[model samples]
Target: MTSYVPEYLKAKNRKTVFDLFLRDPELSRAEIVQRTRMSFPTASKAVDFLISRGIVTEIGSEEPVGRPGRRRRSLRFNPSAYAALALNFEGRVLEVGLVDLAGQLLQYEQHAFDCFHQTENYAQLAPMLQAVVEKSPCHVLGVGIGMPADIDNNAETVALYYDRQEVVVPLKDLFGDLLQALQLQAFYGNDVNLACLGEASLRGGAGEKMNLCYLTLGTGFGAGIMNNGAIWLGGHGRAGEIGNTHLGAFDLKGPLQTQIEPLETRINLQALEKAFGINLLDDTVLPQDTQDQMVEFLLPALVTAVYNFSFLFDMDQFVMSGAIPNRLPGLAACTEREVNRLLAYRKRSVTISRPVSAHCTLIGAANAVFEGTILSELQG
Candidate 1:
């Protein structure tokens, strides 16, 4: 059975319409009505609302055919209407970008912080956001943030978070303040999930109704699960903290290690250095294939991790993406091989998938802003 779009999503169709205008700025009402398959009254109401919000405008007009020529106006998204801020805090720096409703990047900034511990991240971030907000165009909507953390909107904490040094930060608190201070709404999401959201929007995955799990491998590992086009934020808004699961346990030195070894301990950058018996960061003698070997070991483990998660969660398929652009294809291939290997053991088959295009959590962070900004305009 084909599930109908939910009422909330139907109400949010203004976003879908505006997104179309952003794509093709000269679409006629008849074209939009045909594309959206919406009743004329519904389409007119939504389009008029967008026009009133200054998000859409009548670009020009087309003459009606035959007897009495009537000018029918064509609609276009006003490129100058509003803007959004997108930031991704992963790896080397805190990346910031200014994007318009049409997804055009206006400005971008990055501040590299050698130390990203929880104690000082907000101290570092608040000013950066202030600077971006001040420097950005006045029409900017709000900010959207992507972080390597498990965000609990209700509790306002980072349940499981990572920084450059595998440190923790109060993501929700810092985000809440930046949002309030800048007087902008914000969303704090796991980086992997944001990448998934972005891929679902800009990439070929758009308009498809399917369950998706976005797996990210970089300095850290995480997954974003979307079921039937809706984010399944668990009770604590940490549904996809798959990196915390243990692939295998070994007795290491300490109380926390004794508790249980996390998969992060087995596959993160720190683990790769330990596994290779060399310093990948500082050592120049590291072979060219050093990164490849790390992927060979970790990709299989990650594949099993996904298999485990899928079995438990009943997800149909997944995609792998993140900062490691050069490595995604290999990771996808390895994951496919590993999944096939597992199928032999289970005596059953399952589907595995990849994103339609190269992905950046930064891009998705931008989309989060666009989606939210549209929703806000609709409400107001």
Candidate 2:
């Protein structure tokens, strides 16, 4: 049964119609009315408002109607309605991209980093970013930056615990000048979480009716949970901090450090070098063939975390994303096998699977811009 939708929600419905048009430029008025579940008059009113505001346009007519009274007109969102900037502010580099509401990357620029975390670090990043955005062809809606820490979106600030470490200084203030200099509104979020959102929205999971958990395994690890249809950012925006949670203690100086240490410290490219005298980066090696060792080492510790998360969140599907190659295949299969092994010996059965890709966080961050832009219209 459909519940009553409030007037405010109806206004939101209008934006949803715009989003549908943006996602599918060939949608008809009748299709919008049917998909959005609003009255034909209400849907037409929304379309009229959008067209009047220059946010929507009648692209062309649909195919000849076989059994209809009249042909329907196809509607599309104005690609030039607004623009957005997306950045993946990783510890090693800054990836900047200019995109429209349709998630098209019209332009992009990448900047290498000499420093990992410093107060004055982003100063250099500002000019490089401003240069790219300044050349964009659309009215820039805002800039979304992906970082490695938890953010308080409401206060527009990074949280307390994240600012304590010298390696990861206060980031909110540093990003302010870059955003202000470009005259763009800036939003910050955890990189892994952003990547998950991107993957869920842009790729294979778009229309899937299921819960998704994107786990990024790279220099660090984090989980992005999408339940129902929206990203599940916990009450304080820290629900996805699975990497920080301690699974257990390992000897720092022991040879087993590479095996029992945390997944981030164990599976990363650098950690592999410190453990097994080989550099995947320098060797120009494919992660698939070389990452099995790291995965074999870190699988147990990760399983504990995954099982605990399942117990806490009751989620069944898991995705292993982020940049490690051979790591995911063995890691995912091992994690699933272990979980199932443990579960089989216990009470109930469970099903688990690996992520679609390692770059889910990066893609998820991109989708964040798409999701935010379309949803912002509803807020207005």
Candidate 3:
């Protein structure tokens, strides 16, 4: 029983046509109709609308088929027609990026927030956004912020975010000026959730009907969930907060001293450092086979997370990201294998993949504003 949504609500066909241009360098009208399974005229109408908005442009024509018949014009997604101001907030670092429609980061600037040298993050933020917006070559769509915090999607605000020193940062209140000063809208998303969105855009699959989860294993264990090309923030916006789940049973020669701790507190970099009695992720120290030891250590937490996400969200695709997991290539395969063993009775398929680019969070922030503003306008 698949519930149907109105075309105007989702703009299913229009977005499908537009997404093809982003994935492919150029496309023909006939090709769009063929790939999207839309009627010829329907494809043409969407293309015409995009062209009228300067979002899509007719560059030239394709090679004539057979006997040099009438050449069909080639259409391309015009990235310069609009751009988004993307901001990614880590504990101490703030990454400000100017991203075009094709997810290209045209310009990027990094700023330290709330540090001793930069105690005034709010003061530096407005200027940073203004500087990025001033240098854009096209119309600025809006601002997108990706932070490690709970985002209230309905209210369009970051509910809670803390700095490295555990100082509270009211993300929504801080952005009031940057957006208003620049006369732009703002979209807030969880950092990992935005990463998933960035990956989905890069994959450029069939429009809508997309379900994905991105597992992060850097300083902490977390996940980003995506459904229908949007971050599935769930009620109250804590959809993928897997860190606080208590440890589940698994085989390990030596477990952490505080085994009763939450899964995230147990598997994070700090936890591993304390568990292994050294900096497990020290700079320039790529452990030899000891990396395998690290994987074996976190295997229980990783397996449990995948199983929970697969069963709760019922998604078959999971992507593993962050410094530690990405460094260990076998981590994903091992986790997928264990999770499948758990789901063998159900006969369900689950796969764990790795990241294609390191800049997913930045690109995903840009994509948020693009979908909410530009795509909506195009649909209308």
Candidate 4:
């Protein structure tokens, strides 16, 4: 007799099968069953569903070199079935990329604004985006936007700092017409959060249950938390806004007592440049003494931030990115040493490292869009 399976279980099994297929170039039904520990019938059903939906394809049988007679039919993920568009909005630059279902970049472009005022009209770049979408090699699944700011509750607006002023731009309203015309789903998220996702993707999607934090030390300071393979957008989607957290004592009697200086004010690239009189972005190399001095000045605040985050979230690993860390060679090791000194008494330790790729934010935006659209649909 056939066993009765609930719809939720079927959906979960489909997702598992699909995820496995994505991880591996090819898989057989028997292999899927062996890997997932699912019944052969369930695995077969999921494979059949995926094949029917054009998400997967069955190639010819393959025989292992060692095993002579054991020929298994191979199934491969169909990369051409869907595509995603990723847009990363930094302070004054916008980077766009087209990615396939398998997270391969098909095309990429970057646009830099001459001034802050030019970014007010988000729709100004719509024509360029539309041209890319029309030329996509496959069906466009969705668009993902990674903003260098906090997105509001409605997912319709983002609050970004530009020219020493905070501006709220209507995200959905800006892209509404373009998305409607393409009939594509759109997702907006913090750029750092997407960078964390991109870093996780570099690990081949193996950091699902791990508590990973992506700390960015750039023009402004922020962090992205990834727990159990998902972006941990805490209550109100502002979990990684560590820039606003105060690190020093407050003045009880002063009018600005409640408005203590935030951690970002002391450790960002601007602060470093102000303190050392050296532009971090410039190609001119600094003397050993200057580099050491800069490291000494930046290390304490970074260590303090790491300690606070590790203590609060019990982080397993910290991935450092952004303008400063990428520019300074040894920043990661120095930060790690400081964190080690601070957490020496504790039984647990958190690891610190740098990003695997320079295009982490852009790749992450694409991955987020693909996962949010394709994986979400499968799981749902």
Candidate 5:
């Protein structure tokens, strides 16, 4: 006969066991009990519950170290039990990926758009998303959309595209019917914010507790802020708009005609390319003089942003990513030197590094779905 367990206790035990499997990949019932310090009966019940829910699976067994008479059955977190569809909208390209619960990308495809003539063609997203969901290897949990737009997370609406062209898109309204048809929930977030989450996922425990900022230097500039493993969306979910922060005045024509420019105008890929007259996308190495000039123009603004972010959040690290920073070698080291120089008063220097993976935004979108749906389901 099976003993009854309270629903709350069961949920808590399930989370504990699930977290262990996530960290260790595989564990036996004995190991789960030993690591989580739960009674054997409780651990068995939790594992049984997880197996029933298809979250954990019993695979082949391992023999005990001393007895070596019988094998102990191993339980593994079944990453293939569920999948998520991730979409990243980067100016003219829409990248779609099907990712497993383990944050592994199973399939990917890119769709291009003519921004000038085909701005309204974003409606194609539904069929594309539906096709990917149908092709998922497991039960599709939900969809996560990351775009370069000011998102009102509460309403799931795109307040503005910042590119100065696309219309105000109510993303939930555009995708609501599709979500209903597929019977899956939808999540919306800024592309950079999702990228930060992706980067954080790569770090695991180190990232979980650290205050991190993911700054992207591309056609435009933006940042994703993470506070103690959670994405820190401000009062309106617009907290990481570092690109819009105004720097001091500059003499555009002369001292008489000074002008104020945001960080984007002076430090982004477009500005760097225009300043150096070199096409970064062409994959040619920047001339030393060009690199020096680009660094000179960017270092000050970057230092200022880092300085402000450091004081505001007591940030532990800054991750530099996106097109310009990724392509430009030595950018992170250069920026780090500049920031360290400016922050001489601090006892310890801030850590700055590049992303581990190029497809960070796509991975982050999938991660959002996993955390929101799977983790919530486990806890709920």
Candidate 6:
């Protein structure tokens, strides 16, 4: 970590050049030196390192602005220089995608399976993922999977949630064949956390500091927090368990030992179905008042979470994702209005809404690979 260390200096210089290309997408050695205040030789060495790694490309040259005679070779960050295979298992189907260094989802597909056929899940997606890795046209960074489960970073495993319960499994063990065959790194996390990270990347998180929170309501409620542009994973990587946070309690269920209930018990789809006597997720039923009823039922719980997150984190943006908000427009709008009103009283501004892209989890899984690999040097 010392400045006098040669490796440290070299890594630092390469990072500086890498960041420059990210900002401008194209830069000559002269331009890099001028903007970075580094000497010509230092910039050249850094650019050379990136080029050798295939991350920097010489895309010809052009006179930039006023320098008419200064037509030097232009170098750009090659976004497709490395790729990550991203897979999202949303309980039933696996949403697979291929992503490049630039955070773009280059390819995507889905493979459906029965909840009971859990053993066949990863094994089934192997071919599709293998095909993606083979055709990636660039070095494979790794494979990152987002699933409804608890992730153990140290253990390199996940306890996947499916068929209404969690089954402990090492994700790498599931994809061991493909991973070993392709010689790729493996990354995985809770689907909601990945979604939050994905949203941050889309919002230019790479270049700035941000405190953002993402909330999703489904059969299970969850929250993902990004503080200062980095995921706020608590010591155990389980910080955003807002679902288990208590917003309210009632003695109606039991007067003695089990009277209290967590917010998730009330905010999830089962609560909605129990109150409405219909499956909210089932699209066949056309109940005219379904949306209205859903909005009212979820408003209080949603307000509680948003209010707490906004007040505690001081984050201005909240992306409330998941099928509930995406399918029911009224619910998203109501959550926004109610949460904003509470925050306005404290002179704090916040925007509560849905994710801009549907492929958020997929993209975020890919970003995890980049964070661990290509961006790791710059981050340090």
Stretches off by above 4 angstroms in model 1 are 1-10, 19-26, 62-73, 114-118, 121-128, 160-181, 204-210, 247-259, 278-292, 309-317, 323-329, 337-359, 378-380
User: Which runs in model 3 stand beyond 4 Å of their true positions?
Assistant: 1-10, 62-71, 115-121, 161-172, 247-260, 326-329, 341-347, 378-380
Q: Between candidates 2 and 5, name the one with more favorable lDDT.
A: 5
Please give each candidate's TM-score: 0.75, 0.76, 0.85, 0.86, 0.81, 0.81
- How high is the CA lDDT of each candidate model? 0.67, 0.65, 0.78, 0.78, 0.76, 0.76
* Candidate 4 lDDT tens digits, 145-173: 78777786465676656776887767665
Best by TM-score: 4
Candidate 1's TM-score: 0.75
Candidate 2 residue lDDT tens string, 255-289: 76354544455546676667766754454654654
Question: What's model 1's lDDT at 245?
Answer: 83
Q: What is the overall TM-score of model 5 with all chains considered together? A: 0.81
* Residue lDDT tens for model 3, 32-77: 8888788888889888878887989899887866676778889987
Q: Stretches of candidate 6 above 4 Å error?
A: 1-48, 60-75, 114-121, 160-173, 249-257, 284-289, 377-380
Error of 2 at 75 (Å): 1.9
Error of 3 at 286 (Å): 2.7
Whose lDDT is higher: candidate 1's or candidate 4's?
4
Clashing pairs in 5: none
Error of 5 at 98 (Å): 0.4
Off-target runs (Cα >4 Å) in candidate 4 are: 1-12, 62-71, 114-119, 153-155, 161-170, 181-183, 251-259, 378-380
Please provide, for model 5 over 1-380, each residue's C-alpha lDDT reduced to its tens digit, 9 standing for 90 to 100.
Answer: 22545655675566567657766788898898888789999889888877876888889988987775667899888878888888887878878889876667899999885432323544556766778778777898888888887788776667653465545566655666656766778888889999988876665422335578999988878989998767888877788988878877656577633454667887787887677787677878777777777778788878888888888888858999877876666788888887787777766577789887888888789878876665545443
| Candidate 5 runs further than 4 Å off | 1-22, 28-49, 60-73, 114-119, 161-169, 177-183, 205-210, 249-260, 378-380
